[model samples]
Target: MSARLRPTSLPWSVYEHLAMVVGLVSLAVICLAWLPLALALRPVLRGDIGQRLGRLAIMRGFQLYLQVLRGLCACRFDIEAIDALRDQGPMVIAANHPSLLDAVLITSRLPNAVCVMKAEVMENPLFGAGARMAGYVRNDPPLHMVLECRSALRHGAQVLIFPESTRTPGYPANPVNPLSRTAAIIAARAGVPVQTLIVEFSSPYLGKGWPLHRAPRLPLHCRVRLGRRFDPPRDPRAFTTELEAHLRAELAGPKTS
Candidate 1:
């Protein structure tokens, strides 16, 4: 898709109300179908079958959401790294969080992406319902979450995480959350490299006061650029510092960031 040069604007309240309705309806549908589907087929499915089903459902749901956003609210996404994504393995996909739906956007585009979400999401009525079905790793303590992430990748799952921990309220150069050492720690223990994605969304409609129904007159643009992977140091503190410096470097030089 081509980049949208012109910027657009819409009332935040309208989008907010519309989003609430959509979310409620979507949640109801997910709950109604999910229970029956889980009971009827989980026992029948075996081995990679369950994984495949989970992957499909999650991807399909995410894609549908993107499509709806594009069609209804003028949101458009452009994903890069098509070539590198083909040669897949247990990858640690780490990214900066610019928007609330950044994780969902990544999931919609990547295959077999095992997401690391907060424990609260598992309890959230609307999101938890669908996320539980997708089998995302919970945001437990560092040790446990790391082990779970490693296991998922060892099983051919591509792991996606936001090292920034939370979305940036604005497009600031620095990350909002203190850079967590967890990502590097886990990668080093798993003996794997980390793939970096710098995600940016222009004309965001889903932020603090924004809504889903508010369509931007100008199209929204979001991009995920894949960066080279690197090995982590054995020492936890050193690994964390190196990863932080590397991420800062990637965000440096005005042309890219």
Candidate 2:
């Protein structure tokens, strides 16, 4: 019953220390690279090349950030079903928003991705300018945002969206509204399949109410599983239910338990 008795073995404290060192170090690196470009050049760039390069740079920067954070904390990640992302086309990349870093990870791994982020993230001093340069979407007028997502997909861009619309603080597992199906709608309209990702970290930093400075490091074990693609339902309600179900099932793996 004990972890030592089980096939897998590792000390709990080791995981914690690894998490702390990695998180802090990576956070520092992110501030150094992303903050500068986001603050300085992001405002000056425009058009496709600028946007594309910005997104790619920011995503890559964040990837390094997460990697160093996990390494320092002594946390590790194991990804499965990577082939699901191999086939390329305009895709609806939907995933559970567990941490602020989730989008960064997803974007870095996926090509031609335009994130569906909150309007505020576009205004935040830390993320706003870079997000705009990357041509990420804002959570604006419900119908209009959906339409814009449709347009982005039509233009041959893979659109990434957190169905929950915002970070899940209170009930991280459960969705907030469950009414909005913006991602699904866009997928259905474009006749593209939805690619679902379940991102789980052994212990996360930004999820819930933990303050940034006071946050404790837990082993930053991350499992990114890409689920089987499914067609968006014709009916809006059914589409939403199916999307949510896919995400939950992907994240609720017994192996994770």
Candidate 3:
């Protein structure tokens, strides 16, 4: 898949909204079905087994979602280094946020991943119940979020954090937002390396305000690549600067075949 990472109007735009509605309804049903099970099974799937099961459910759901998007929406994916995550450890998997799907893609691949999600999402009807029960971290009160993530990492679990803290403004050389340094702080204090993961989509189907009805390129595609794993620098400010530069380079690099 050729990498353009920009938006373009296409014929498929016509079906985009319909597909989205169908997908959303299906997802609601799926989540509704599992949320209760997650609540009820909390006692039985206790300890490591419960954690594993929850993550597995998420992964399988994403797998199915990807299939649906591919088949119904004609979107394609070019993902690399997914298998590399399996061998990685209790490390901070930092990423450049592009779209909401970014987290799903990574968390799906890293079955043991502990994601740090926004407080609103933690209370959302579609995701809240399941996520809370599944043991993901809530991004609130910076200290609690940091401690939770750090503990998860120290316990030999992979933690995914969008260092940008929110979706990007959506363009190359875009101004990096002044955001929370929670991710950087967590990695530094925990003595874990920050693995920078770069995600570039062929179509910016969902930008800041772009609706699900917006039609992007046919067979929307994306490229997921792994960048360097950096040992936490002593200075958090310097680390954030370097991380931004590194992510910019990764996002601006030549497209892969």
Top TM-score: which candidate number? Answer: 3
Displacement of the residue 36 alpha carbon in candidate 2, Å: 4.5
Best by lDDT: 3
lDDT of each: 0.66, 0.68, 0.75
- How large is the C-alpha RMSD of every model relative to the true structure? 4.6, 4.4, 3.9
Candidate 2 has which clashing residue pairs, if any? 18-73, 18-74, 19-73, 22-69, 22-72, 22-73
Count of backbone collisions within predicted model 2: 6
Candidate 2 residues 29-119, lDDT tens each? 6755676776677657656777778777876776677667555654566653543574487888887776776776677675568888777
lDDT of 1 at 142: 73
Per candidate, the number of residue pairs that clash is: 3, 6, 1
Worst 10 residues of 1 by lDDT: 1-10
| lDDT by residue (tens digit), candidate 3, 44-91 | 777767877887788778777777777786667766477697777888
Clashing pairs in 1: 15-211, 15-212, 16-211
User: Which portions of model 1 miss their true places by more than 4 Å?
Assistant: 1-40, 43-47, 173-176, 204-218, 252-257
Worst 10 residues of 2 by lDDT: 170-179
